[model samples]
Target: MDGQPTADVVDQVKDIPIYRTSVERGHFPILEKPEIADGFPDNWMTPRLAAALAAGEAEFVLSTGTNHARMQIIRPPYFLLNSYYKLWSEHPDISATWEAGCQRVSLTTVLATEHVARVNAKKRGGEPEAVPPLDDRRLDARTLYLNLRLDPALWERDDVVRMLAEIRTAQQAHPRGWYHLDCSGYHLAHLVQKARAWGLWEDFPQPASIIHAYEYTPLNVRRHLREHFTCPVVDLFGSTELGYLYYSDRHGHYRPYLDEMSVELVPVAPGSRIHSLIVSSVRNPYMPLIRYRSGDCARTLDGSPDPEKISRFCGREKELLATPHGPVAQADLDDRIADASPRVFLHQLHVTAGEAVLHHTTFDGEPLDPRACAVLERELRGLTGLRSRIEHREHIPVGKSGKYAWLVQDR
Candidate 1:
């Protein structure tokens, strides 16, 4: 488990105790969550890093652990956020938002619970503060603002009334102010959907630009944002351990923005188009992950595992559903649903030993017709070779992280 990256890229850490006594430079063995957790701080800790941690100079970043094993990584302060800012400032689509003097506002999935807490506190006319401390630093003269977080549980009747009131309050502070919507959480899409339902769409300000990172955004959510807002919707691919490595253009095509990192796409299985992302990053001063399997899965253009031709990041590697035909990924389900109809907003596939049930909702606020539902059920059976049932619901459940899962194994 104590394997050092063999890649020459980690030459800087060659003398470090953790790296010096471990595996060769080019042969980076997969670093599993269990292995990381088993050792915790001792395995990767060095004298300098240990001192920094004791002095509060380094911080622990918790993994969302939505679909993967939960783990924590220690790094310097603002390491991940600063890295994202750099990537954002460099991207052509996002740079325009910065130039327009719009600040970045994050309302993504992870902020949901905290967002709800703050909103409820404010409802009682109390001052609410942010947890994890907002990085209020300026990037290119534009401030990066972290507003209240959003949790899906609050999307219910009683709380949503308060949620809307809170959202309107935030919106009024910057009406038509051209702010960048940094939707790192689940709020924006749900906010838009619910606001429209409650006849309060006009109260929310139009974003100057939209940046989606930190979570897997459903196609329906993307469609809703694009149709309602005229701003550019950019998707970024990265994690807390690594900075923003790739970004989607206005056309939704991902292009590399690796600052000081390199990547290799290795197939999860032989002849499989889905490849696990193995990244080598010495970008973080306190931590360097070399040839590290990121636990995220992706596919390449033309169905080959070429790093340069990677087309789409499918989903988490551990979530790949085993089928008689082969492994079916989240992207496979997404493709099938979109082919059936673009109206399908959110979906969750619960795979049990006997059957798989698809709980889904459409954008029109109505259940899918019998024909469309049958088509989707058949598609699931064809791909997964499992008895499939389609539950056309008015609403699908969201995880506490405020993210939706395309596939879930019944435990």
Candidate 2:
């Protein structure tokens, strides 16, 4: 989401009085959007599109390049009302995230470290700090850093100081207000490192919750916040078509924001713990779906999921690591990594040569303590049903579709 302006998004909501009556009468579509009555695809943007169209905007589109490839949802007004039902159903607090001077912020680069790109380019105590150029926003609010000349070998000094300055500026602009930090995990991890190097750790602003929604948060980075910060460091799961379906608490555990969603689980294969996440979300009435397969995988941690204790939100179903023994889910491995560090930010588990390589991103700005890494390896080896290699990656690659891939296979 990038620079989404506030229009009368509420007018997009379908009639609620009749739907609420239905819900009270033990019929769910009671409060559902109108498009729901007509039916639409699971991932369609019918309701949201409806709102955008009413405002007369054609740029309404869904996110591409994440796990499910990319899907474009065209929303008209009928579809717009559906979004209200879905967003406010279970998670009423979400309105706050949007209410706090919120707008969508996105980038073309899979791994963007706008926060610390210049600092990583410097030599200790050498030059006057410099900052990279501010993004040029098209009057339409779209931005592109794709051609920003960021040569790794030639990071100058002036921009390093400038980057730090920018981060401070944004955080202070709303010291007590809420803001979404929607950057890559790598970008966040690098920024943390730069903060330590510049002795600016003390100056870092404290937001209500640090949201690592756009990319995966490594276990080590998660621990740092739990060990240090007073506020919550949370993450969420959803696609562009649907705004958000789930969010985690302060301790990195997922809870469903069902809205008007009826979720189902189907096995990826026989006798496999991994199940496909089928969602019938009614957020965009203009695009109501029935039994829609979202192409993501999740397993109930208990016999019946508690909803509140959804320990993990594994990435794309197609990316599950299948082997002779069974399939290894990403969330399971991440839990093990978090067990190793109190503060982690991003992670990549590579299956190579019959062993799992755990590459982590950290807010601590360094590889996990060697002893902790060794201990983590032992736990991961047992979890993955294979040997383990726990290490760090300077930058883990986000999927071609712009989602993080927890598991990768290389012969």
If scored against the real structure, what TM-score would every candidate get?
0.84, 0.64
lDDT score, candidate 2, position 329: 68
lDDT of each: 0.70, 0.52
Measured with C-alpha atoms, the lDDT of residue 281 in candidate 2 is 53
Instruction: Give the C-alpha miss distance for residue 62 in model 2, angstroms.
Output: 4.4
Q: Who wins the lDDT comparison?
A: 1
Query: CA shift at 207, candidate 2, in angstroms?
Result: 2.4
Model 2's alpha-carbon lDDT is 0.52
Writing each residue's lDDT as its tens digit, candidate 1 over 178-199 gives 5677774345767677777777
Candidate 2 per-residue lDDT, tens place, 150-201, comes to 3311223443455445544554555354443444444454545565666766
- Report the C-alpha displacement of residue 116, candidate 1, in angstroms: 13
